[model samples]
Target chain A: MNKWTKLDNAAIVFPSLAKAKNSTIYRVSAVLKETVLPVRLQQALDITVKRYPMMTMRIHKGLFWRYMEYDDEPLRVKREDDYPCHPLQDRMTMEALLKVFYYQRRISVEVFHAITDGSGAMEFLKTLVYEYLRLLGKAVEPEDKIRTASEDIHPEELEDSFHRYYTPGRPPKIRNTKAYQITGTYFEPYGNNVTQGVVSASALRQIAKKQGATLTEFLLALLMYTIYRQSSQDRKDQRPIKVSVPVNLRQMFPSKTLRNFFAVALFEISSQQEQSLFKILCAIKEQSVKNYSKKVLQEAIVRNINLEKIKIARFIPLPIKDIIVKNRYFLYNDKLRTCTMTNLGRVDLPKTMTPYVDRMEVVFYPTANNPLNCGLCTVNDNMTISFSRTIRENRIIGEYFRYLSQEYGLEVKIYSNEWGISD
Target chain B: MNGGFQINHCIHCQVTVEASLQECPLCGKKLTNTRLSVPRSYPAYALHNKSSYYFQLFWKTLVPLMFIGAFLIPSLITLLTGEGDLWLNRETLGIASAWVLVRYTFLSRMHMGKKFLLQIMNISLALFIFDHVGEARGWSVNYVIPFMLICSTLAMMYIVYKRKRLWSDYAVYVMTLIFLGFLPSFLYLIRVTSLLWPSAAAAGFAIVSLIAVYFFLDKNFRSYFNRRLHF
Candidate 1:
């Protein structure tokens, strides 16, 4: 509550790179069985903001760096308007870096990346929905998964976990990475087109088990294969379809901070067209296992902290640092990834809350360079795979959904925000 | 598919579309079954209406139009008309004034109090520049800036009073405007201006506004300074 705090290590990179075209905003939503009541939702949000005071902080530029300060204005719960992942700028960031919106049956929380990562945002969404359900007179308990309003705020929740766990001078376990970037005609009004596919979580897990892999490894291979199938025969082996997967570090190292504490693990599949998806899944599992050694994560934490700790980098004015970051982003940020996919794995709610909730979705905003990004989460028995893109052509999406249906015989129920299509 | 939900089967895409959508979001193929439908998972959003479409077009052309409309068109007309007064002409001043005001007022996303102070300063600057170089080179500071400062202070005081909860956040800006209101007095005392009454009125108004705020909202101003220092 004392005025301001520094941006987390991973969060430092996003503010400099964010713009209208390359928004670093990501969304996590829950669709309840009943229609959303705005009044009750607003009340829930007001309570939630008090419980999580960090959500009310706004980022401001200092002479040396950007930092977050407590913004005391009351938070407004907006009725859903505009397309998803429109840039959060100026007034939006000035008010608060996080926003909560509601549609027909959907209550969504869109977060600026400078504030929190996917895991942290998911925690906020779950707590918000829990409070909403309670306000509606439901008998839902926190059940240890949700952050309850009655519980005392712990100091550990505010610690910058990345800085806490960074190990200095550890050499990175690196690899030669070059990925194929998806390109298509840009949408006239720049916005994210979200296409989500809902399937049975148990069925997805069973199928992954049949292929001798975890759900993430299985989906990572399938995504690569889908993109590979769409390419011409001449371009099939031209480049590896690499997916940048974010792994939550709380599982490995013990930390309860609701901030960015995750690392990226790159999984690739190349020249595996002749093999079945099962073989590709096995190969991806192997590659992913090798890439995710603790050394790799330690190096990521160290490197990120080191970049900001450079003596000269700190003294240089923030505007000049932003220019340097922007120039570097245009040259290299998305040059090595086909797309980004962050899976929340499994979302568990209190037993009493399950009947009211239908599904949960995590939709990441696609950057201009990396035109396609995927996010998915499983709650109860339903798994939703959401692909958000900034392009006109959605052939990859159609093919991915179709492939999941025809190959695994997984019943795919598809829906979208329909940003671009006229009809 | 298991919930007896009215769903669309897209044969081409080979996926079952939710009942909310009339066509496949991926393939654009119409729903195979056209019948009475259940509630959709999402609202049927008007993706782009006429106003929004025009706005999109305007947004796309805004940058190029800012350069051409603000700079090129007026300069071109002046060149063709043989009125080559690039910096000091009436037409040029009018266009520049419009451009600065429009950009700062309409486009800036700063906090409302900050933006208001900046806009008033911008207008005062333009007026000062115009007055100093013109045949009449004294009115801006002597009358215009002092009056503008007094008005700005009153406006900010009103905002602070109306939005009591926001007083803590906006009080600093009001204080800033009060500090700026002394500039004309400084100018007059330094003999940069001949008239002292206008400067005196402006500073007198500013001090009176501050006294009123302090006298009435003593606790509020105290807490304002308490929260003023940032970590």
Candidate 2:
């Protein structure tokens, strides 16, 4: 017998929408100062999985929807061989929804979206790395920052905060328009190619503060402007380049559940008339301020929870509901957004564990509709802006990094997984 | 790690990116500067192993093509000869259904007990259809259907007894199979099935099983089905 849990309000859409081409798996990795030892990593994973019992389960299809069943067995940590964020194949079986992989000096944790969000994944990664370092006899302390193996699992960690925060019968009317989509050739051998540009987080923050914009807003404006400049001369091409920004709700609510408790805020802008990047920044700033409010964020939570509460939706069989969700998911989503950019603002590890960790990277999985996505994660002073894409043309990615380096004079270092690069 | 001392700066983009590449990946410009070699942050995934993905894609594509061709070739021959109105004659339908049954059995990741029950039901349906159109022979309802229902019920009981841990999950399916066994007796009462012995056996076994389960496992199944069929 296993303890079962339901998928959160924001998580129910992922399992149906996932396909071979569009695997809804995101990764959070940390490069260590030393090479990864597989045996020690496996031991560390066993201990860490026990610590975060909420993430220690496999996804199973239930009568009405999907649920997670506790797997008493330990999850195996494999050596990294596949492309980053490839689909987890043991979905319907007894394997853990989260996988731990090691390649040389990097340790990556890839998770199916149905289990948890980025914040949850990050906490698991931090704990796993801490245990791995401590196992190797490094002088690392939890400093009460990392969840150690001895701590008891909190009931609040497994709580679905969305259901707690949502108010019944308060559905807000949302207006959505089709946005300008980025078009490019689908790269052969279908994989996620990650290209990361690392720069100083403080220096970039100083520039954003001078421009009267937050770092996320400034980056969104920069991305929108890049696409606008590259748009064709036709009038139809001047559509709003909408970037979906996922707002972590732990900041607003006092709940500390490690499940999905985030709401997406769509940052949209376009240039019907000729507009400068400054104007784009101003537009993004205005929208961000409004959209970042607690009232609007509450509306987002209410809107999502209301969809799951439809009278008819509860009675449909899981198989038929899977078909309906697969066909209708993109119609209501991804069409309204050009791409997504999720910023996991600065990750602070305990000072005792800082020297062994090099830097961290957040990899957002790209979908079929939105072929490119950006993930920002700052550790120590380094902010890595990783572009995970499935298409061949990288003009938007190329220009964004160049603009950051040239305009701001930030010494940006770069690396890639090189999935489809010719040379 | 900032271990790169060689600045492979692309003058075309006027920005430095990779420290080891011979050319900039963005502009494809020649930025070959070699001084200190640094280990890469990510493994070079340029060497892609296309076997697993392409193999799955191959079967998914080829199975549908084979199914289409199987239907089309016979239809084309019949249209050219003008010998048939329905392109899928009895034999062709049987062959196609057999192929589909085999494919479903191999491909479905469903629970085993449910899959077994569904497979037997499908086979019984094909037998029923075969009797209806072929000779109007009463063999399907008279013998084959009732016997299959009886045997499937016994098999379901054996499975439930063997896997008692998953008995709750299998409880609904096993009970459904037992209830389906009573259908043959109904057909006999309606005079659609004239042979009384096969129908009596199936219905008798179903009644005995029902009595035993009600006496022995009533409390168990009552609670299980209550939550499952609540909606």
What DockQ would candidate 1 receive versus the native complex? Answer: 0.33
Model 2 clash pairs are: none
Return the top candidate by TM-score: 2
Badly placed stretches (over 4 Å) of model 1 are A89-94, A170-178, A231-240, A269-283, B1-4, B35-37, B46-50, B56-88, B107-109, B141-143, B146-231
Q: How well does candidate 2 match the true structure in TM-score terms?
A: 0.87
Worst 10 residues of 1 chain A by lDDT: A229-238
- Considering only chain B, report the TM-score of each candidate against the true chain B: 0.75, 0.70
lDDT by residue (B51-138, candidate 1, tens digit) is 5656645644675477677677867777789876755355555566666676666755667888788888888878877886676668
* Number of clashes recorded per candidate: 0, 0
Among incorrect, acceptable, medium and high, the docking class of model 1 is acceptable
TM-score on 0 to 1 scale for chain A of candidate 1: 0.96
List TM-scores for all candidates, in order.
0.85, 0.87
TM-score of chain A of 2: 0.96
